[model samples]
Target: MFFIMIIILSITYTDSYANSAHSAIVMDVKTGRILYSKNISAKKPMASTTKIMTALLALEYGDLEAFVKVDKNAVGVEGSSIYLKYDEEVKLKDLVYGLMLRSGNDSAAAIAYHISGSIEEFSNLMNKRAKEIGANNTNFKNPHGLHHKDHYTTAYDLALITRQALLNEDFNKIVRTKRWISEREGYNTFYNKNKTLNQFKGGDGVKTGYTRAAGRCLVTSATRNGMQIISVVLNDPNWFNDCYFLMEEAFREYSPEKVITRNNDIKSFRINNGKVERSYMIAKEDIVIPVKEEEKDKIYIVFECNETYEAPVRKGQKLGKAKIYIGDRLIGTTELFAKENIEKRKLIDIIKNFFSK
Candidate 1:
């Protein structure tokens, strides 16, 4: 009786939470699988979310500890900035902090100049990286996400960029950090502007932006109970409340599930002497899913193997594949292989086996 009541309560909670988001999405950061989404693909200009890529390119290509001279081009660009002076000397690391924490427009230009020799060239690099990452709706015209006719990205694309950024050890470290102070002759402090870091429970560091043209845009990430979700809100009247409610909904609805693990052996079938035998399989890599906790037991796995394999099989040879499916959706797939070599029978043994068959 207790078990039945628990199941009922769980389902009700999932239903209510799943329907509670206004333009929200929950996805596995590694696999890019959408756990839940509402109007996530709608195209919109992403304000300072552009910094994730700017910082990414700088980290990948620019030397962090190298000294950077604030060029004339970087000195007077409008909008928010740390107020860099012309010909001022600052380390690349300090500028990155300014770029991310304060969304410094001058720092963006400095990074752009350092990376591509000019803002025009760096903008090209941004576009190239965006396409490479499968952000189809994104086009970056400026490093600072200033409004341009062509500069736009959707919630889904920002999630993709964030996922890619998280893969880089350096990029992840920078975004997750809430505060930074540069090692200069005098103390230079940069505080992370992501209000979620100070306001929300379990709120990890991320980027936030606002402008008259791009109103109250924010991309937030949080983790709880081993589940991490990234939420993006654009042009919301009440951006903080909307984002908080959306993230809370995702946390309430989705629970982390181990989709594939190195130790979780999968069973498969092999043909030997035209007879089927049970063979075990394992994942080449671990996979995880963000799903409702109650749905964990209902998850189903399918092991799709080759229709047939001739004798003389060797270990680790590619046989076919298997996948886990929940309803009609594919959760994960693993390559199927022979656990051990199965040698063909000797001619005499084959003759005897044929006669027995």
Candidate 2:
């Protein structure tokens, strides 16, 4: 038989990702790892991406089935809208769907007013929530992103906000939906503008935005093989393509590698004045890390704990930590625990232990 040549082309992140956005980032949702970055921390106008926070807060504060009366102030808000009329009563959940799926400025205002009594107060809540989620660089001046001078967020901060929002089951369900019908009398239907939901195989959600000042902005997320990846692109003409490519690159190059398995023996520690001369320490949970394929070889673990533990060790007691590193970069740490109990040695047992030693 003729020989079949097989070439395993090793691809690096630098070669695969060449984004053109003014600011961009790709993060592993589970581990909070930044897979790729290009000016991710630079603050830029986010356009309707601000609705993500608005939707999150609405979900947190408003009862989905409760009726929300649209304030007159919310009726004529600028930019994209769901055409909500003044005094129109709609379910709070439906308004959120309109806000997220339709990028409705009007809906954003209604939800903001319903939840916090005014957009200004709602914005203060937004800033507070942003800080709680570690989106330190983000500042929200309005519920809807309309290019206000004081409103801006970094790609990294937006990703953090999205990550926090994704933790809520209802929020996750709403964003991933492709189409939804409001509970209004006419059954108003709204379609999601996030193109990645149709373009990519596992595309789920996030949001999309555009304005004269912000240009084009998009936040896209996809899940595959038990891993979810989130990507953001700001002020890019080819935002969909950039996000798609970045997500694909992340999936192809990196994977969640378990550095330490839960309850697996990590290292042996000497036990002083105990029935057992030694005790084994193990990880409390799986320490999974997102790492490049080639970078796997560079991964290493360092153990930190007391040289010897005193007797009366209890099972699952905290002993130390295992710090995982990849080429000097600390990826993450896991708590090490005693695998089993080691009771204090009695005088009779001490004599037997000394003789065995």
Candidate 3:
């Protein structure tokens, strides 16, 4: 028997997600799967939410715990500020906290200069990271998204960027932080402007932004039962409320289905050579995707592997691959591995006589 196994999973449909924002989206943080969307690809000004990228760049290229003096130009740029003075020394980590928690434009500038030597250069890096994250529609003209005609991102792109940022533990901690006290000379305490952390259950992070031209924008993330989701809204009068609705609806409608468990048996195969007569196959990683609960029966995992193995089966050895399907659509795949080490069977009966039974 050629060991082909199909594991049934579930996924279905739900009503459309509604929101008042001009462009909005909800994405599963783990899989980058969109749970909800409305005009998600429309490019719009990102405002202070731009700081999310600013913070991400710093975490990637700058030393967090190192103390560095603020650049001369970072002081008193525009919009929100941690009021960093020229040549003021602060830890790179604190600047990130200020950038995220306080939505500090000055902190954004300081970080930009500290990391890339100039705002122009830093924006270049931001664009580079956006591309790497698959946010092709996003562009950064300045570290602090004040107002540059070209500085914009689609709701989907922003959500993608936020998803990338959320992967960093440091970034995650900063955005979720409600208040931060820096060692700066004045206005030492910074309170996060993103109210989503306090306004909704399971709300953890992201950022908030507003400018007359951009209306109001918000990016929010929440975690429930080990599943995290990111939501982005651009140019909305009721940003927070819209985000909350998006979050609630997604959580209510979708489920993180663990279609495959890591290091667990997916199928057992008969062996021809050594050790045990049978060997089991498993995936090296878990495939968890968000899907509608009622449609669970529609999702299935198709395991592709050989019916039997010839020789020794090494634990963790790649045996085959599992294709995850939502209905007929192939959603994802993971490589399957041997569950345990099975040494080859030794020549028995006659050998025992030679050894003396």
RMSD of each: 7.2, 7.6, 5.4
TM-score of 3: 0.83
Which regions of candidate 2 are displaced past 4 Å? 1-15, 260-287, 298-324, 333-357
Q: How does candidate 2 fare on TM-score?
A: 0.78
Q: What lDDT does candidate 3 reach at residue 341?
A: 86
- Clash-forming residue pairs, model 1: none
List candidate 1 stretches off by more than 4 Å: 1-24, 185-187, 262-285, 301-322, 332-357
Candidate 1: give its CA RMSD in angstroms.
7.2
lDDT of 3: 0.83
Against the true structure, what is each candidate's TM-score? 0.76, 0.78, 0.83
User: What's the best-to-worst order under TM-score?
Assistant: 3, 2, 1
Candidate 2 clashing pairs, residues 3+ apart or interchain:
none
lDDT of each candidate versus the true structure: 0.73, 0.85, 0.83
Which is better, 1 or 2, measured by lDDT?
Answer: 2
Candidate 1 lDDT for residue 185: 49
Residue lDDT tens for model 3, 108-142: 98899888889899999999999988889999999
lDDT of 1 at 288: 58
